[model samples]
Target: MGVATTWHGTTILGVLRDGVVAVAGDGQVTAGDVVLKHRARKIRPLFDGHVVAGFAGAVADALTLFDKFEQHLKAWDGDLRRAAVELAREWRTDRYLRRLEAQLLVGDPGQLLLLSGEGDVIEPDDGVAAIGTGGPYAAAAARALLRHTGLTAPQIARAAMQVAADLCIYTNDQVTLITVPPERQEYEADDR
Candidate 1:
């Protein structure tokens, strides 16, 4: 029997700055050495648009994880960290979920987290996280931009994805970005 081929190719970056959180993802999908699609959206808004998530790995698996994470968010009342932790635990322990090959970067107004199938829920010290084939490249660029420039979270995320696209063949320039508004804004909108 031949081995099953896994679909790949994506770069997801999340940046938190000045009370804003932005997540960006590339639109490239690859199977083996072949480029399958461009303009594939890997970033999604969750928790009544108060949270943003991006994924890197098999498309189907990531989608499933997204749904699961959303359920956790609802259960936890939109708590980003709590939802991420629950997802990570289930992804690691559940027999069916353990086979999923994907990584997630999720953020809300107050937190940025990286979730893995290995039960890891990591929050970066600098409020920046990335995953996928070009993750390292994007993450490094994001850190530099965050430190040196006064760009907003979205701008930094976009720039970082661009840098990743330029360097990684698997990553493309077509980026989908989503942002979660600050906590104060959410409260203000509720009051209005």
Candidate 2:
């Protein structure tokens, strides 16, 4: 389902704390090299159970992948990481799907992840991570927060958002977050 679609701007970030895991993304939609829309939601709740997904590519592909991923997760006894890797493998193996590139992050209570084209699921320690356009800035800020101040999950998320916003114009209305309790495999999206 694609003639051409460049109106895809998104970011995905994840952090693993001692007891909780948090993630965030920016909201911007662009076509090719032009900004087509602002305040687009890149992060979304897939199953409303406990896991969240952030995509950065064809919106259609994102939707399709997410649905399939959800189905697989449900059938697999809620294995978030394994499910995410399977999603990436499917995307990479399927020729048409390979074209609609997307990045995804799946997290549970004690783990946070970054999923990409090569089917990489990177778990950043020191609990700092980010993706999309403002990824670098957010990651940097997360590192600073982790190093300089002992902040909670919310504080780290806010700091990452602020830093990302300062570095990228798209982040002003794009800061989004989700958290999972240490003992849980699902997550809750933060409204603030």
Best by lDDT: 1
**How high is the lDDT of residue 31 in model 2?**
68
lDDT of 2 at 32: 70
TM-score of each: 0.91, 0.80
Give residue 17's lDDT in candidate 2 (0 to 100). Answer: 68
After the best TM-score superposition of candidate 1, give how far the Cα of residue 126 lies from its true spot, in angstroms: 0.4
lDDT of 2 by residue, 71-188 (tens): 8788777788778778778777877767766677677666667777676777777677677777787788888887888787656866787777777754554555656653323223
Model 2 poorest ten-residue lDDT run: 183-192
Error of 1 at 20 (Å): 0.8
For residue 32, model 2's alpha carbon misses the true position, in angstroms, by 6.0
